[model samples]
Target: FWESLLMQLLLFRESLLIHLLLFRESLLIKLLLFWESLLMQLLLFRESLLIHLLLFRESLLIQILLFRENLLMQLLFFRESLLTQLLLFRESLLTQLLLFRESLLIQLLLFRESLLIQLLLFWESLLIQLLLFRE
Candidate 1:
């Protein structure tokens, strides 16, 4: 019975770890997709602005230059922010995984201790029984 329970606990732990891994992967993919979409949008906006400037001549050139500079600044800020978020998320995931591993180790140790106690109890009972039979 204890063995069966232990097996179930192990299986549960494996499944939980697998789920956490999948969740972490999905989060990373989502962040990557978000960053990619932002880049694509920036490129499209820049191309549209360039086309407008070409059609309008010098009048629009000044505005286009300013807009481009501002856009670049914004992009730089956004990229930095995204990078920071990614690093933070990665660190959080690592911490969670480490904690889960520690918990699993603790649980396993407890299971082992319980099994040892059971074995000792069984031995003591057997010794008592033998003495009674001899009497």
Candidate 2:
């Protein structure tokens, strides 16, 4: 009977040692899995941050392009308006020059008519004076 009890005690000790080893192995595996999950989460977070940064940069570039386009449109409008004003100024100058030319032509005609009248009066006076001298 004592030998049987000794054998049973040794078997229980061996089984306890085996159970302890398995528990230790399972605990190590669980810790390693937890660490791996944490590492994957960190990598995913970093990737998301990079994506957000790229999107922000793209949006900023688009805003700059839009501002430049608006500026170009304004400059174009300004140039068109300036051209129209210049054309109007040119037309007004031409009209003034034509008016000046017409006035000068009318003045020249009046001067010629006055000179002819004076010549006719001088001739009539000379004839009368000659006739009086003859009488």
TM-score of 2: 0.69
- The regions of model 1 sitting more than 4 angstroms off are 1-56
Error (Å) of candidate 2 at residue 27 is: 4.2
RMSD (Cα, Å) for all candidates, in order, is: 51.2, 3.6
Q: What are the per-model numbers of colliding residue pairs? A: 0, 0
Error of 2 at 92 (Å): 0.8
TM-score of 1: 0.53
lDDT of each: 0.95, 0.94
Give per-residue CA lDDT, model 2, range 1-135, as digits (tens). Answer: 999999999999899999999999999999999999999999999999999999999999999999999999999999999999999999999999999999998888888888888887888888889999899
Q: Lowest-lDDT window of 10 residues in candidate 1?
A: 53-62
- TM-score to native of every candidate shown: 0.53, 0.69
